[model samples]
Target: MCIFCKIAKKEIPAKLVLEDDDLVAFHDINAQAPIHVLVIPKQHITGIGEVTDEHVTVLGKLLVAARRIAEDAGLSQSGFRVVVNHGQHAGQTVHHLHVHVLGGRPLAWPPG
Candidate 1:
């Protein structure tokens, strides 16, 4: 199984921040900001390219969860950033579809 699948299965440990039927949010192992969380689907999905109409609900859930995570991390007032690295060229190290929620400091433009 993929690493995220393992995390979702509790086979791998993650600093879980939020979880529900559709997705889970956890702290990024290599945090880029004071509050950097990864929100991923419970089901295994390679990347955004693999997302289909069936994934619409779960995809929306990811954003909703990110918003909640940002609030819980105390970035709600200052605002936060959400990123989805779609492919290898885009710096997606892991194949699983995940959203990066980052905040708690000033983020520069031209992010990679």
Candidate 2:
């Protein structure tokens, strides 16, 4: 199983922010921002490229969880960014589909 799958199954430990039957939000091991978190679906969907109609509900839940996490972390008013890296070129190290929530500082216009 993939590392993210292991996290969801409780085989691996993650700094979880939020969790439900559909998805989970956890702190990124390699944080890119002060308030960085990774929100992912419990079911392994590989990446955004693999998403189908059946994955819509869980995808929505993932985004919602991201927003909730950001608010809980006190980044809602300061603003936050949500990102999804689709492939290797996009900086996706994990195979599982996940959303990145970044905030707690001034973000540049052109993100690298």
Candidate 3:
């Protein structure tokens, strides 16, 4: 199984932040900022391009969900950023598609 699947199934340990039937969000073990959460779909998809039109609603839902989680995590008025890395060159370490919500400090432009 993929690393994310393992994390979801509890086969591996992760700093879980949220979960449900179709989605899951968690704190990255190695965070880039004070608040860095990774929200992912239950099914395995390597990138946004891999998501079918049937997934469009869920895709949008993930964004809304991320916002909700961000607010819940105390970033509502403070603002935050969402990111989806598509491929290896973009810094995607897991094969599963995920939305990264980051905030709690000033973010640099032209991300490194």
Candidate 4:
């Protein structure tokens, strides 16, 4: 099973921020920003290429959850960034679909 699947199943511990029946949000182990959180669907849909219309609800839930987490972390007013790496070429180390909520600083343009 994928690492994220383990996290969703509660077999692997995660610093959870928000969780409901369909999705979960947690702190990133390798935080890129002062406030970096990962929001993922519990269904293990792999990557964006694999997502179908069936995933629309969970996908939207991910963003909604990310927004809530960012606001709770006090980044709503300061602004934040939400990103999804599509594949390995795009810097997606994990196969499972996930959203990165990054903030707590003045983010530069042309993010590399």
Worst 10 residues of 4 by lDDT: 58-67
Q: In candidate 4, which residue ranges exceed 4 Å CA deviation?
A: none
Candidate 4: what lDDT? 0.93
Candidate 3 lDDT trough over 10 residues, lowest sum: 40-49
The CA lDDT of each predicted structure is: 0.93, 0.92, 0.87, 0.93
User: What's the CA RMSD for each of the models?
Assistant: 0.7, 0.7, 1.2, 0.7
How much is 85 displaced in model 4, in angstroms? 0.4
Can you write out model 2's per-residue Cα lDDT over 1-112, one digit (the tens) per residue? 9999999998999998898998888999999899999998989999999999999899888888888888899998899999999998998999999999999999998888
lDDT of 2 at 63: 85
Writing each residue's lDDT as its tens digit, candidate 1 over 18-45 gives 9998898899999999989999999999
TM-score per candidate: 0.97, 0.97, 0.92, 0.97
TM-score for candidate 1, residues paired by index? 0.97
Tens digits of per-residue lDDT for model 3, 79-108: 889999988888888888899999999889
